[model samples]
Target: MNFSLQQPLENESVKLVPLKNNDFDALYQVASDKDIWMQHPNKDRWKKEVFQLFFEGAIQSKGAFKIIDKSSNEIVGCTRFYDYQESDKSILIGYTFYATKHWGTGLNPSVKKLMMDYIFQFVNRILLHVGAGNLRSQIAVGRLGATKIAEESVAYYGEASKLNFIYEIKKEDYLSVS
Candidate 1:
């Protein structure tokens, strides 16, 4: 099967739709809360101008998605699958953020499980890069059964390098768990 990030994915709790140019405003509404980015590498993303650049990159990536709540049919957050390395049958999933209201609600795992179930059909491994200081994200990925493999400085689109911990989950391990 072909691996295409533009494909829409969904589950009972969330729907991952291919992000469109028009989604900037609705998605931003969920992202604008300062508490949402407090632990993120770029806390200033709550600003319109800063988030505009992020929205631009997401549209350009062609692999980003606007996460929607299935029950409310409202936008809740955003995430993306990037840096696909076919040689190793691996891809990285990162740049994820959700509204503070959605935090600790199991939304991250719901969204990630949906993503993993779809992507495992085409890859052997999936990686996630979480900001080094972002303990919340680190713990979240750990709960997803991903193992920390490395730590390095990652340069996000339109942003400077930030220390990040690399977590990896192999298809076999994730499959067994599910």
Candidate 2:
């Protein structure tokens, strides 16, 4: 079977559904908080126009998801599975952000665990690109046992390139982590 990035993924805490055009308002509700983007590479993404472009790119990726809080049944964040490298047998999981209210909770890892559990079935490695200055995300990925392998320039879908730290986790390593 072909690897499908937008497939519905869920665990006890959250559900990741394939993003759709109509999901704009709901997702924007979660993303509009300036604090949500404070540590993100695109800090002003909370604005309507900027987020519109970001949302547009997400739609085009065909791999984006609107994350939902299972208990509240409300949109809480967004993430994606992108840049699948066939030759290297790897896929990237990134463009992730969660509502500030969810921060410091176990939601991030819970969400990542669900994604890793699903994606590891199809690839040997998973990669993440975090903004160089985004300490929050860097620490989160580190907790997942991903090592910072390199620093490189990563251009957003339609935006300029920015410095990013590439973190990688091998399937064997992730599996061995308790």
Candidate 3:
């Protein structure tokens, strides 16, 4: 239970830091853009109220982070690991969003690598839930070598939505890849 919780994970390609107060302006700028949240479960489309609510939740949960570009020192996106069920020895990694520019590049792979590497240090398994309709995310999860386990309608943002696929990777499997 004494897990070392820290922020701002950095590697050669990207930096994953806690979403702090200073990130408000930058996060709000990108999060407020309608195009960013189009495929997201939260249909609010990053509106002011939605962003506020999201940030508040993130702060309270203490499980999210802002993705920063080390070279340019710019905020490129956000990702997090939440809903930790210690009794089940499982945790969920979602609420990820990256700027259009960061998409398609190896940035995501590198970020995920860092997160998974860190997470497996203490947990036995990790779960990723992707919207079924989001092919991009689905493929990403598959590329991570996670096996799809099930699908269900879960409440996200504010409503009960269907087509959420749950993918899981055990510690042994993760070690094989890492």
Candidate 4:
């Protein structure tokens, strides 16, 4: 079976729509906040020049999504599914960021559950790369039952490599948790 990464996904709280070339401004508006990328590997992503490269990569990836708040109908963040390895039956989900307002509102897990529910139908495991210093993301992934299995220097699209912790969630593990 072919795996499609950009399929639209949503729950009662948020929606994931295929990101378009025209979405640069809207997504950038949410990402412009300095705090948003403070702990991210590419801390300069808040800059237009850097973010343009990131957005270009997302567009080329063909698996990026713009996250929208259902109630406000506003673009709150962006995420993507990338590096799908058929041999390993695994995929990586990262490049996720949300507005500060949604930080502790259970939206992350909901969005993750939505993605996992859909992708688990095609793959056996989902891997995530969290910035080494990003304690918030580390905690969040842990809460979703993902385990830190390794550390490596990961290269961001059109950016320098940075130390990152790899987290894994097997289909069975996610099923048991959710």
List per-candidate RMSD values in Å: 1.0, 1.0, 1.8, 0.8
lDDT of 4 by residue, 1-178 (tens): 4868999998989999999999999999988899998888788899999999999999999999999999999999998999999999999999999998899999899889999999999999999999999999999999989999999999888788999999999999888867
lDDT of 1: 0.92
Q: What's each prediction's TM-score? A: 0.98, 0.97, 0.90, 0.98
Worst-scoring 10-residue span by lDDT in model 2: 1-10
Better of 3 and 4 by TM-score: 4
Q: What is the per-residue lDDT of model 3 for residues 1-178, given as tens digits with 9 covering 90 to 100?
A: 5564344688997889888767777988778777777776675757887788777767666878998888899888888888777897788888788887778888788888889888888788999988877778889889988899999877665445657899998989989877
Q: Is 3 or 4 the stronger prediction by lDDT?
A: 4
> lDDT of model 1 at residue 144?
98
User: What's the C-alpha lDDT at position 71 in model 1?
Assistant: 94
For model 4 the TM-score comes to 0.98
